[model samples]
Target: MATKPEFLLIGPGGVGCIAAFTINYNHTANVSIVVRRDYETVRKHGYHIDSVDYGKVDGWKPENVFASVEEASKSGIKFDYIAVSTKNLQDIVPVEELIAPVVSAHSVVVLVQNGFGIEKPLFAKFPQNIVLSGVSHIGSHNRNGHIHQMQSDHLVISAFENPNVDADSQVAAANRFIEMYSNNINKCVYFASAKWYRYRKLVYNACLNTTCALTGVDTGRLEAAGGLEAIAIPAMKEVIRVAKADGVELPDDVINVVCHADDGDYFEPSMRVDVKKGNPIELEAILGNLLDTARKLKVETPILDLLFKLLTVVQFRLKEANGYVGVPEKRPIPDTFFK
Candidate 1:
């Protein structure tokens, strides 16, 4: 009997939860998940996902479930592919830090996460390792431990095109993920320019995620309240401008794609859910970093500037309220942060 290809996914958030389930549901690999604190419940009750297109799934279990990276590393298991799908809240614990324990020279590391400039740090750390970038369009969240898949499209992933990237390992990891994720419930595709795709995803993420989170509203609320035209579209245009400055020729029509893709008008993005739950949001990776790049490139982003300011205050208050020491930002919430 032959052994199945090993896959390790860290961070059981929206994309992580679905990716883990999809791998198991598709029989893709001997999938092992590294969830932060939901082991006992998930192991006993399994993961319950209420997928809109796929219907309800009760307690779908993976091949193996581990709590931390050290556990998997200590076991002397070598994974063919290792993916990090956690929030890009590296200030809490970098995506690299968690996966470093289990990563080997031959392992393919997929940063299935949000934000721009995220994959650079890992690529610098392990040049020999095959590094891939991934972005998800799935509208879902694991509220109270069960995943709620509200909406979705194909997950976009791509491998390193640089000459230095290990050809064999990198190609195999990218194709393998595509093969596994092309199931009835969902689809995953590969593109030549992942960096370009990252910037495109950022249009929705930076605009909608931040706007929705700060306003404490979903897409529907933004539309209902007429904030979409007032705030969301402007913020998205700024992202497009910044992307062009970075040499990525993104189309202006993408702004319309985001505006129309506001499925059901009530879909809550991951960042919005994080803010509502009082969990620390990815302020730096998602918003500030992009703003920083725009500044460096001398790109004018007045709209993004204001969004960054408001979202930072939201982050500060949410962290303080939750009693979690989050990544420091420019502003501090006043004593009367809540009226």
Candidate 2:
């Protein structure tokens, strides 16, 4: 009998919870979720996954849960795959330190966070061969300590064949990882050839997240106003220009599928929720990366530049007014929108 591959998911937030539940439900991987000390509530209450596509799931618990990476390491448990789905602003230094001792030399780390340039910093510490990048169009939120997954479009993973890893081995590994979650969720996971998935998702996120946060409107209102195409088309073009300079060959359909999709208001991006809660928005990950790439490629992105500056100012002001701490309560809808 073949042994089940062991997986460790760092962080138990929305994305992390989805990843853990998906992996556990499929039973293809032995998954463990590493959370903070406060996650004892999860130990008692278990997890409730309320998904729009898959329906409701209750009493779902991980194979194991640990308060800290150090504790998991002390247990002498080695993981074959490590997936991280934490927020963008989190400091991963401690995670890297604690997990390093428990990761086998052949173990692969899949990062499902936002942004484009995250791999560079991670590769600096870990072997480039063992690092992989992924992007997802999954929308989710936490309500009253339960995870509500609103949408699952598709997950794209970038596969690379390192000198230490053969092409067939890497392909097999990627396939196994994809199949592990194929049945647990409604979305499809595609393993793409190049690393363009990150850039493609970056373009989609930059426009959707920034616009929704700035307007303080839901996606439905944004679409109703016919402003999606106006903002998204130009932003995608600028991203394409910058990506090409970086030697990435993005497909023409990336923009068409991402920007022109007809998903309903249920598709609220994470940045929108962050702004609604008055938390620090992921400006650095979504827009900062775009502007940084443009600067490097000498591409002009005046629209993106303007949007980034505006969002930064709004985030700063909101933080200052809200005492710069704690999640903000949902704000009341404006009278202007009620008309």
Candidate 3:
């Protein structure tokens, strides 16, 4: 009999918890999660998941839980897949560095995070391994070891295009993941063009996600303050234009689709939640990378440029206040300047 495939997921947050649950529940693989901060809580009591697709469950956990990737690496079992569901804050620490300790020669790295151009560094670091982009469309929130997954888990999995890896190998790796992840309870489909999906998601992420963080409000509040029309729509349009310049033609009604996708629900974007909690946002991965692509294609994105500039300051302040190393030493403004 063939041995069960070993799957290790990092960051047992909303997406990670769901991924671990579905894979383990379906008996598809032997699942493990690398947790930090919440390790003790989760290891002691397990995870409490209230999922829309899987129904409510209490004290649920993966087959194995490690304190960190380094700890997981020391377990003597090589992982076939390493799925990362953490925030893609590349500015603070590269994602490649975090997972490198546990990545095996045959391991396929699966990214279940949001951001444009997030796979470049990972591609550079793990040239031989397949990097699958799992674009998740799920409304979920997690606090401590408890998770509330409201929306259905519809993950679009695709292999990031890599020159170093052959197309057949990449597709096979992605299809294997789709086979392992998909079951009667959830949907995990293979997408041929992951870049198109990433661009589509940016219509909302680049606009509402950044603007809400800047205004320090939820989507409804931002809409009420006229920011939806004044800031978000224009930025979203700019994203469409940039996507076009990058050769991905989005539908004409995409802006409207993104605007009303949530149906006026009161929700905070992940970036806004990060700002509120004093956590570093994925500014570089989300906005900076897209803007870089736009610049290369000579696409004009005035609104996004403005948002990026403003958020750069926000990110700087958060890093400084949080005492992140490499932040410049503080210096008071000169009193003589006022004179």
Candidate 4:
């Protein structure tokens, strides 16, 4: 009999739970979830998934749950793949330690998170050969202890191709990972060249996330307010220009998709949630990255610059108010043609 691929998921947050559930539900992979604590809770309660599409699935326990990577290592457990889904701001030290023992030179490490260039920091810690960067449009949040999946879109996997890593091999691996959830489901997994996938996602995020965050409205409402023509269209053009300056080739249709994507009303950008909850937003990851890239490539980004400035002020005001409970003055975007 073929041995099941050992999969280890670090963190049991919304994304982590969905990944764990997806992997366990569809594939024969021997999956385990590593948590900082709450092993008892997970063991007793199992994994609970409340999805708008899949409905509620309860009492589904992982093959194993470990409190820490240290514990898993001491128990002599080895993982073929490690999926890191921690919050973007969490210290990477713990994650490094967790992957240290289990990650081999050949083992694949898939990072399912938002933002651009998140793989750079990890590359400094681990060999680039084993690192794979992924971006997904999967919306999920935790309610009580259950994970609620709001939407499932395509999962894009990318990494710098190496001789040991055949192009087809990565695609096959990505498909295996997707099959963990795509059975009879319309959701598909795509493996593509890192440059195109990363930049495409970057453009989509740069437009959609920033607009949703700045407007403090849901995606549907934002799209309804001529956001595509006003914000997303302009912002996406800037993204394409910046990507071109950076030598990243983007498709002509990328802008159209960003402007007209069916992201659903239930979709909530992380930055908007952070602003609403008064948590520190990923200004650096979403907007800051675009601005920085533009500067690096000598590309002008007036729209992004104005957007970033507005968001910075909004964030500061929120911090001053201690939360979004009180209303703040609505700042108008300075007049400028970014083209």
Across 1-339, the per-residue lDDT of candidate 4 in tens digits comes to 688888888877877787777778776688988866567777788767887556799877788888787777676766777888875542213345556766766577887766665555555566444566666667777655678888864566665344445667766666665555465653655656665666787777777777888888867877778776788778888988988887888887877776556565556667788888776666656677668778988999898888888888876666567554455388678699898
Give the whole-model CA lDDT for all candidates, comma-separated.
0.81, 0.72, 0.90, 0.71
lDDT of 2 by residue, 12-127 (tens): 66666777877787788888887784477777777787977557988677888877777777777778888877766522233355457667676788777787666554555665
RMSD of each: 4.7, 7.4, 2.6, 6.8
Taking all chains together, each candidate's TM-score versus the true structure is 0.84, 0.78, 0.93, 0.76
In model 4, the runs with Cα more than 4 Å from the true position are 36-40, 51-55, 90-102, 150-154, 160-186, 220-232, 262-267, 309-339
Model 4 C-alpha RMSD vs. true structure (Å) is 6.8
Per-residue lDDT of 260-303 in model 3, one digit per residue for the tens?
Answer: 87785898998998999999999987899999999999999999
Q: Which stretches of candidate 2 lie over 4 Å from their true place?
A: 51-56, 90-104, 150-154, 160-169, 184-188, 223-232, 249-257, 262-267, 313-339
RMSD of 1: 4.7
Best by lDDT: 3
TM-score of 1: 0.84
Better of 1 and 2 by lDDT: 1
